[model samples]
Target chain A: MKLKVFLAVFACKLTIKLLRLLGRGGTAIPGKIALRICPDLLFQLAKDVKCVVVTGTNGKTTSSRIIEEIYVKAEASYFANRSGANLINGITSIFIENSTLTGKPKKENAVIECDEAASKEVCRLINPAVVLVTNVFRDQLDRYGEVSGTLENILIGIKNSPRAVVCLNSDCSLTASIAEQIPNRVIFYGVDVPIYKNPVSEVSDAPHCIKCKHEYEYSYRTFGHLGGFCCPDCGYKRPEPQVSVTDILSTELSFTKVRVQVFGEDDVITINLPGGYNIYNAVGALAVSEAVGFRRMLAKDAIASFTCGFGRMEEFDLGGHSARIILVKNPAGANQVLNYLAGLSAETVFVCCLNDNSADGKDVSWVWDANFEKLADMSELIPEIYVSGIRSGDMAVRLKYAGIDEDKLRIFDDYDELIDAMKNQSLPVIIMPTYTAMMDLRAKMSTAFGGKEFWE
Target chain B: MKLSICHLYPDVLNLYGDTGNIICLKKRLEWRGIDTEVTLLPIGANADLSRFDLFFIGGGQDFEQEVLLTDLHGGKDKEILAAVEDEKVFLCICGGYQMMGQYYLTHTGQQCDYIGALKLHTVGSDVRMIGNYMFKCAEESSGSTIVGFENHSGRTYLGEGVSPLGTVLHGFGNNGEDHTEGARFKNVFGAYCHGPMLPKNPEFADLILQTALSRRYPGTVLPPLGDGLEINAHDHMADRMEKQ
Candidate 1:
């Protein structure tokens, strides 16, 4: 019976691979079968190899890629869902890509980036050896309901899985609270990065302490409550991280650089990503790799060479100017992009695109909260800012208030107009787009410019 | 010299990036040599509200409003009531406006008692309100057309004599009625438009800070904001929202 089932699955995968080779969207075919039958095979397959899974509301995509890159540098074959397709189909698709025709995976380790709700189901199937959660924020509230609910899903996966969890000690109050739930070794990663240049603190979502019901006080905030924090009443402070990222230099004139003071030695890693959150993302990766038996030096070297893990921080030379393509799906991600753009030296133009798709909360109010004003405060350097998307008018209004000059502001709710506005513009454009917006931006880039060859 | 600003429950009622509103106000005020002290008073933050010059509240989910209502209801100091009575500047937007009124009707029809500042009532239902919005600020409202996004699941009704912040541009406008987009009692101003409110709208921040300045320094002449102020071309959005 098992032999027949294996044969059918193997044949299905073979056919899909053929279809993919022949130019089709056959990537989802493996998941189409695995999510239904032989789901048990996933856990069995992962037992022999080291599997590190990172899932949370934010920072998981970048962190997962960083971890995978570290493993890749160590010469260990790794596979991760780099496309931010963090669901059942996405996980299965990643596993299938790493698998051979005989149902055995080619890689020794898999870094699966699971979605918030889907993480539990995928972990139950994959039984990963390590899990790293970056931070939790009030993202897609219409979809995820609340921050507590998102944390509950992460806790569900962490509680059941016997694998060690590399948790972010600074993810507000709830993420650290989950440290008590999991029996596995919890490796916590955090940063002591300074927010000096940024005089005022930007307000972020999801701040109530789960225990005392009082707002958690921040000694200092890197982003959201993902820094030193403590509750006033219950004394539930942010856990003392086992692995801390200190001496973090976010004042990078180029290449979102930071020196992570890990294990009594400063491991300086210059990442091709942007924002202080990326520092946390790297800390999440460095913490996980170090916990999973990779030497500290080897892990640092891996992240050092790692440039642009997929579209997380992909730089594109469009005709003449360089465009850093970073995905801004939610407020935290969007705010980080603003932070990066604020520190950038290039003659900058911000092409902020908004979409009401499932990834970008149908609630565009999240934008009103992002620190566009801070981006606006640094406006002397900024010549023009392009606000484009289905919600271009919204972004245009946002930049306008950011004290961005109307002439400097152009609203292109239409992609064609956005690309037309972007094509060979004199200033170095920072293509800060949401999820599917990137697809549209990439497609336009492919046709207008050369192709996805910029990624090469 | 310490001017206390009430960043009221920023972590909780902060639906939009209202924290940016406070950040913009603080930085701008500080730029003008005001010794600005921002006290983030969460749901149960330890701080004296009586010393507060500016009281600020952002938007949030209906559940968050419900959760915070009891705490906010209890913590309503006489100083806050006096501030409202005196028409001192308190910046409230969207859900904050809804919750600051007499009552907020939840989706289940339960009446949640508001702080009774605005003469209005907001009722929530199943259908959520989320989209980019614009508003034509009143003539006295010396600022650009208020442009931002409104994401809420509530409908607010302004009673007689109440004026909205401006005519709604896009988004759901103002709840179900053609009511005022925001509420004002002297220095206290409320609106639904948020793009983290102030970051994108320095003019509005200046207006709020001017209210603070008038209250604090009396007849002190304030210099106008320096150069780099640009006229944002979002009139198209206002035009589009008006047609809708």
Candidate 2:
């Protein structure tokens, strides 16, 4: 058994070295090969590590990054899947990479961002001390099948890791419901007050109650079905969260100040990122930190110091023009980006890069589920709209159907052409791209202007 | 003439941009100087179903489908079946299409009875058939080619009473084995293609509109609007599917 573990770790380390030499981002493949050699490679390497696995549809990366800052601020040695490889293979690789040849982990603490579908296998193997499920939404139907299926996957993971403290987003009925089925100690986090003044009516992934098929009536929805909700007939309601945002002091373009009650104590915290979703992430991270036994003040401060993850509200400068790329994978996430854009009073050029790649969810149909009508409403503020990526035409049509004028719509299939066009614009640009599209466009943007590789 | 379109169970059945189909129908009608009143009939919403000229039902998750079936038994199924028999235009996609069938035999051989509006039955599989597919409408219809995304595990086989919406040009259709894509009975249209089905395929959208409009205003023709963007988007997928 010891020889098998040693051989797997050695092979994985060698694979990473070869891939790095080939100028490739050695993320998930190496771990996959290691797992092939020894199926229990992660379980062996992660035996001694205290891992906080962040899983859900949205905010996994952002939530994990914030938790990483908390770990860093606590002055604890840790490692993470910083390359956005949240799957089983990628996670396995990260664990093996941070471990010695004998499968002993170098880092004592680990902040792992796990994919929703892969969370079941990941949690079972790693046996993490903390499992934080951010929220569940309809994402990548081609991969996860459906939203409930996504919830079920996370549930199975949590069920397997009974010893792990489960930190759930209480406001999300779909997420909060996980507490009902599991016997694990649960910590809930959510926003108590509505974040947005004018909330757009979008589709709720969990419109019906999980316990009973009754519709959920919300007392207040912060954004995208996250709020105080109660099912009338079933009596299943949003559980009282341990860490919650009580009031929003201010929300600027760069940062947001909110007063939150962390386990009965009121404290004001500043989330470095914008949008209501980040506020959820802030509370979620705080909850996970609490579950992991970190000091409350340290966790709060870490959230304030935390920077944006790759393509997750990550900003860039093109010549003199400013551009920010927000990675949008599904309708819920896209709507959050739209929510952020709604607050933009400044004149901005909105660019949407839609791709049908496997990572991007081959069905580009979810674009229709998003409220692009909000964009049409703010047509004056957004003078020009650029559609790029492989499915740029589909995006253009979606925007067109959303009532954005045909004259304002510009389709650019080439990244070079799109980036070149951005150079001439004096106005600030907000580029929203799918997962794979962001990689392609960001690589081009980084080369054209100045930035570092995401993995670096 | 004004057309009243009912969006059925939009809250539950709206999985993949299903509202886009509604938006497409409303916008296409408005473009031709035709008035449209869209009524959203979610679960437990009470209204006379016969009042609406056309109905649009989208796909949903397995859990949602189960929830919708409960609502259907609460009298929505009868209205849906009556509408189909009356030849009132209906556009049902994926789960919605499966609901119109006799029963969905689960992978474990568990039979879930659906509203038997169309003479068809579906068998659920563990593997989901999902991708962009192209198909040509059956000769009885416009015979125009349509392109859209199909994501479903249920392999639907049409009974003798119903005709197919189209012949599978590329990609898997009703079942991977059968080249048939969707089932069509009278003015009822059911398919797995839901790139929200209509926004990209303007011709198909117009076909549905013409059928519904002709019911009230006999010989009513829809004036064509510019569909350059729609055609370009449709052809992009169609061309890719053909190459494959």
Candidate 3:
């Protein structure tokens, strides 16, 4: 077993070095090779490191970044899979890269963002100290089958890590239901108050009660089926959150200030990122921090100081004009970004890059599910609308049906052309791209304009 | 002219932008100066099916479909069947399409009965048929080519005497085995395509609208809206499908 572990580590390290030399970014390939050599290599490398695994549909990367800040502020020795490589192979590669050739971890702690479907086996092997599920939304239906299947996958992960403290979003009924099934130490986090003045109502992924088949009744919905929910028939309700945003003091383009109640004590927290969705992520980060033995003030300060995640409201100065790339995959996330765009009073140019790549959930039908109608509703604020990517036509059609004037719509199949169009414009540009589209466009923008590569 | 559209079980079955069909139907009618009302009948809602001229049921996950089976068995199926027999225009997609069939046999050999509004039955498989696909409407229909995305694991087969809504031109339709895509019986239409099935295919959207409207005003002709964007989107998919 020891020989196998050592051989796996050596092979993985060699592959990583070779890939770097070849100028190829293969985050999951080396780990795949190592795992083939020794299937138990992850269990060996992750044995000594304390880990906090963040997994869910929407806020995994953002929440993990916030937790990384908490780790940094505390001056703890840690490593992270910060390159959006959340699958088992990618996570294994991260572990092996952070460890010695003998399959022993050099880092004392780790912050890992894991994909929901991959979390089941990854969490079992890593045996994290704290497992945080930000929230579960209907995402990548072709990949996970459905929202319930995603929930089941996460549930199995939480179930496997029985010793790990499970932190859940109380507002998400699908996520919150995991608490009922697991025997682990569970913590809940949510936003107590409605975050938006005018919330867009899309179809709820978890409309019926998990316990009973009855529809859920919301007292006040924050956005996209999340809020104070209670099932009338079986009495399944949103649990009282231990860490929650009690009130929103103010919301700005860059940040949001909110009064948060942790346990019984209340404190005002300035979430460095904007949008109501990030508020939930901030509170979720705090809850995970609490579970991981970080001080409340440390977590609060970390959230205040943490920058945005890659392609998540990530800013770039292109030819002296400001452009922000907001990654949108599913309806719930897209609606939140749309809500944030709606809040902007300044004239803006909206760029939507939609791809049907495997990473982007090939079914582009989700464009219709998201409330792009919000853009049409507030067309006075948005001067120009540009659509790009493999499915640009589908996106253009969706916007047309959403009531946006066809004259304002432009389709750019090339990223360079899309960037040029945005750069030529005077107004601030907000680019919303699907996963693969963002990666491709961000790479082009990084090369032409100036920004760090996503992995770096 | 006015038409009421009952979006049946939208709470449970609104997966894959399925409500886009509702948006397309509503917008097409409203664009023609026809007053349109959309009513959402969630699970356990007491819906008088006869009041609505058109009905739509989207798809859902197997878990949601399972949860919905109880509600359907609790007498809602009777209402839906009655409405289908009344020749009310109905559009069902994916799981909703499967539900309109007689029954669905699961991979585990468990048989689940549905409303049986059409002469069809489906069998679930582990291998899911998912991708962009194109099909041509049956001869009796517009015979226009329709493009949409299909993602389903249930292989549905229409019973004898029942006609298919369309023939698969490219990609897997009802099942990968058969060239048939969706079932058409009376005024009901069922398909597995949910690139929400309507917005991009303006002709199909208009056809459903015209059929529903003609119930109130016979020989109702829909004025053709400028479908340049929709046609471009549709052609993109059709072109891609042809290339593949």
Docking class of 2: high
lDDT of 3 by residue, A140-203 (tens): 8888778888988999998889789999999999899999898889999998999999877677
Q: Candidate order by DockQ, highest to lowest?
A: 2, 3, 1
lDDT of 1 by residue, A391-451 (tens): 6755765665566667887777688877776774767778888776887777677667654
Q: Against the unseen true structure, what C-alpha lDDT does each candidate score?
A: 0.69, 0.90, 0.90
lDDT tens readout by residue for model 2, B122-234: 99888878888888998776688989888888899999889999999888999999799898998989999888888998888898999999997898888889999999998
**Candidate 2: which stretches are off by over 4 Å?**
none
lDDT score for candidate 2 against the true structure: 0.90
The superposed Cα distance between candidate 1 and the true structure at residue A72, in angstroms, equals 1.9
TM-scores vs. true structure, each candidate: 0.75, 0.98, 0.97
> For each candidate, C-alpha RMSD in Å?
6.3, 1.4, 1.7
Off by over 4 Å in 1: A1-30, A33-49, A100-102, A249-251, A256-261, A264-274, A413-417, A420-423, A447-456, B1-11, B18-57, B61-71, B75-244
Best by DockQ: 2
lDDT of 1 at A36: 66
DockQ of each model against the real complex? 0.25, 0.83, 0.77
Q: Model 3 residue B236 lDDT?
A: 87
